[model samples]
Every structure is written in structure tokens, then in C-alpha cells.
Target: MADETESGERGNVKTGGCLCGSVRYEVRGELRPVVNCHCSQCRKTHGHFIGYTSADRNDLVLAEESGLRWYQSSEKARRGFCHQCGASLFWEPTEGSSVAISAGTLDAPTGLKTVRHIFVAEKGDYYEIDDGLPQFPGTMRGHPLPEA
Candidate 1:
């Protein structure tokens, strides 16, 4: 990866934990720009549209996981959260080596920006996505990444 240096350490590193510190993690890799998912499952799980930033699974190290639990949210993916604090933390695709980390769970000054909105077709009717960022009617699977 271009972000890696001679020692194989990524140029960027970040740390975060759950509300109760039951699930702490160190991400020794580049974090993707944040993407907001408006899918119903995300809304239900997070009580609102959820923002996520991704990192390679290999680059993620769980510093503490005593209270971590995984929920198979769908046949394609699973969600991870802190059992003690009920803090949603991760979204991992069943077939991928990259995992999405809940942006809100990361420590402040993440140097990340919300780049796009996904699953807009299923977004709740009560609110409008007025930020004027790129909005996709569904997932970003086949779509181009928004210009940062």
C-alpha cells in the first residue's frame, strides 16, 4: 500500500474504543474517507444514518475485546459492537478483507471527511440529505468513489 513506509507501518494510525472502553482498537492503516449509509439496518442499529470509514482487516488490531460481540446482520455482512455499552463499532463484509469502522466510534480529529451518501433510496422519510454530497440510490459497489 502506498501508505506503508519501509518498516511496513502505514503512514496513518488511529485508535478508538467503545463507550465503556470494553472494545478498544488500533488501526495501523489508512482510513478511507467517511461514507454515510442510509440503509434501514444502519438506521436501526445506530438510531440514525451511520457514517463509516474503512481499513484493511489485517491492519486492524483489537487492543481489547472482552465485551465485543458480532451479529450477522445479513448473509453478506456482520456487525460488531460492544456488549457492555451497546456501542456499534464495525461492519465487515463476509467476502472482503476490509472492515468498515463506525466513524463516530473513532477518536476526534480523525482527519476524515464525509465523502458520499449510500442507500439513499431506502433512507427514512423524516429527514433529508441536504449536505449536497454525492448520493447514491443504493450501495457504492459499482459506483465510482466521490472526489475528495
Candidate 2:
């Protein structure tokens, strides 16, 4: 994913799910551009770097969660995944500040792009961050996410 620009909010609606369709969700309103996360926890959860776009807690709605399970990764954060398919679905702050939805799980034509990379300092040595986007050693909120 590369950086791409989009216009005003379209009140767009997006739907996504786990590989086994056990966890489905709907996100309304505008979504932030994709941010590639290189933190160790993210890499372990998704089996690699995790690509995600975010939205307010109010905008993300889980339509189905029969197979959804949340793992409290740390004191301040927890990760959501499908118990059946073991697909990573979300990363959210324990305070419910916002939710990070996996970009790959989103339905096509999301009109989203990779705006930057986060936690670059912890990135694995197996891959290189060749993308020219800004690489931050912290979270997007820590660096203030760039414009789309």
C-alpha cells in the first residue's frame, strides 16, 4: 500500500470479516489511511507486520462476534481475533479511545492507502522499510498521523 489522497468524507460504509466468516464487522463514517505497524506484538498477531486503518470507537461496529475473542496483550491494549480462523481483526486501546481495523480484512475498494509506518524501530530484520513514507518509532498518535 502506498500513500493516496481522498476527498471529503463520503459517509462511506465498509464491511470486513475473518477468513472463516466467523467475525464480521461494519465501520461507518470516514476511516484513517492505512498505517503499517512493525511492533513485535503486531507482527506476532498477524504473522507479519499489521496493516490497519483506524476510526473512532463509535464508528466501528461488530456485526458478528460469535467466534471473536480478545486477547489483552498489555495493560493498555488488547487485540481482537477470530477463535475459529485465528485471523487478527482489531487492535484497540484498553481505554476505548479508538480501534484499528486490519486493512487486509476490509472489503475491496476501501479507497485507503498506506500513509506511514509505525513502531519502525522494532521492525523485524527480515524485511526492509523501502516505502518512502514517514517511519515512526512510536504509535501514529505519538507522531500525529499525517494527512491522507
Candidate 3:
């Protein structure tokens, strides 16, 4: 696999559209730390554990929002989805500094590098996280790390 550093230096912009293609977005800046979230809510929302990445909201641009939907998942967090097809798109902290874009939503070759695993204790019993990334016992809410 190509390293994220090499891929990022190429400025290969990653773009994705909703399942129905009504909503589209482009991640234009360098991709940073990526994470796999195993929280119950995430698993329920995506029908599986979700992969996410931390990025400055400014780095994300909704090229089209005709089918976008925002759900306030909690007092401090909200999740964006495709209203037309109910495809989960991204998660953002209501007051934090960054956004967590669904890694699977991005078109392949996004230069995203997985650096950690979260909500391990709450993870579904059906799958195992085999990646060597750091595992946190729960959600990463107030840590000094980036949004993912």
C-alpha cells in the first residue's frame, strides 16, 4: 500500500458522493490520523463499526448539499447523513475544533492513515480489531488528540 505521506504530497483530493449521488463532498487538505470507532451508536448508525478521520472542518467542503441531513446525536455531537438514502456521512463535535469524516465514504486512495482504535470495550462481539493501532477503552471526547 502507498504510504499516506506520499499520497498526501501528491495533493490527490478525495471526493465522495452519497449512495444516490445527490450529496457530494471533497476533502482537500492533507489527511491526518484516522480511527476505527466501535461505539454502540456508531455501530448501530452504520450497521457496523465505522472508520473515521480527523480533519479541520475548513478542510472539508460540501461540494453539494442537496441531500444532506444533520442529526444531533448527542448534546455534544452531531452526525451528518444523506437524507435521500440515509447513508451516514460524517460526525462532528458540537464545540470541538475538528470533524470526523466517515472513512468508507471517501473514494478510495484518500491518503488516510489509521492511527488508533476507539470504543474497544463497547465494540460488538462479532468482529475483532486486528490492526495494531492504539486501542482506547472508550470514545475520545476530551483528549488532546484531533477529532477522530
Those runs of model 2 whose alpha carbons end farther than 4 Å from true positions after fitting are: 1-11
Q: Candidate 1, clashing residue pairs?
A: none
For model 1, what is the error of residue 3's alpha carbon versus the real structure, in angstroms, after optimal superposition?
A: 20
**Model 1 stretches with alpha carbons more than 4 Å out:** 1-11, 146-148
- Candidate 3 residues 49-110, lDDT tens each? 88887678888889889999899999989999999999898899998678888887777666
The global C-alpha lDDT for each of the candidates, from Candidate 1 onward, is: 0.90, 0.84, 0.80
Error of 1 at 115 (Å): 0.6
lDDT of 1: 0.90
TM-scores, each model vs. reference: 0.90, 0.88, 0.83
- Which candidate would rank higher by lDDT, 2 or 3? 2
The best candidate by TM-score is 1
Q: Put down candidate 1 lDDT per residue, 20-93, tens digits, no spaces.
A: 99998879878889999999999999999999999999999998999999999999999999999999999999
Q: Rank candidates, TM-score, best first.
A: 1, 2, 3
CA lDDT, candidate 1, residue 44: 99
